[model samples]
Target: MSALIYCPFPDREAARAAANTLLDRKLIACANLLGEVESIYSWNGERGDSFEIGALFKTSAALLDDAIQCLAEMHPYDTPAIMGWRCVSVSEATAAWLGELDRGG
Candidate 1:
């Protein structure tokens, strides 16, 4: 199985850096960095908002937990937003690649 992991970062540079790290480490095969995502939330019991970048990573399900752990360790925020869901359908080539990744190929 594979997943499309979603995570939000405070800046494009941060998102790109994270993406590169994941890709280089083979934790993720690809990362789509969507920048300029406007976000609204309450922080420290106060209403706040800002533009953020979203990172969508393509990776096997086996890497989800560890990848999120790494993100938590490296994240700058008090709590980082990292979520992932299994991919039920994908191209055969992509699926095979994900399997290979899980096998540490």
Candidate 2:
């Protein structure tokens, strides 16, 4: 199954750099860098906020865990938010395209 992964970065350059790394490693097939994200949260017993950039990654379930690990390692923030969910359905063409890279075979 295919998956869509979400991760936020400090800037577009950071997002693009990470995306390129993941693509080179075959951990993700594609990434969509969504602009300026306003985030609010509580951490270390304090309310926190951030103006970040977000990216959506496309990969397969088989590679999701690996992708998360890689993203964490390269993420600028200590506590990066990396999330993903399996795609229940996709267009035939999308499936076909994603399938080509999903298996890493």
Highest lDDT: give the candidate number: 2
Per-prediction TM-score: 0.90, 0.93
Which lDDT values do the candidates have, in the order given?
A: 0.84, 0.90
Candidate 1: tens digits of C-alpha lDDT, residues 1-105: 888888899898888888888877788888898767888999889998888988888888898877777777877787988998888898889899888878877
Clashes within 3 Å, all models in order: 0, 0
Q: How accurate locally is residue 88 in candidate 2, as Cα lDDT from 0 to 100?
A: 83
Best by TM-score: 2
Candidate 2 positional error at 84, Å: 0.9
In model 1, the worst 10-residue window by lDDT is 67-76
User: Over the stretch 1-105, how does candidate 2's per-residue lDDT look in tens digits?
Assistant: 789999999999999999999999988889999899999989989998889998999988778899999999999889898998999898888877778776673
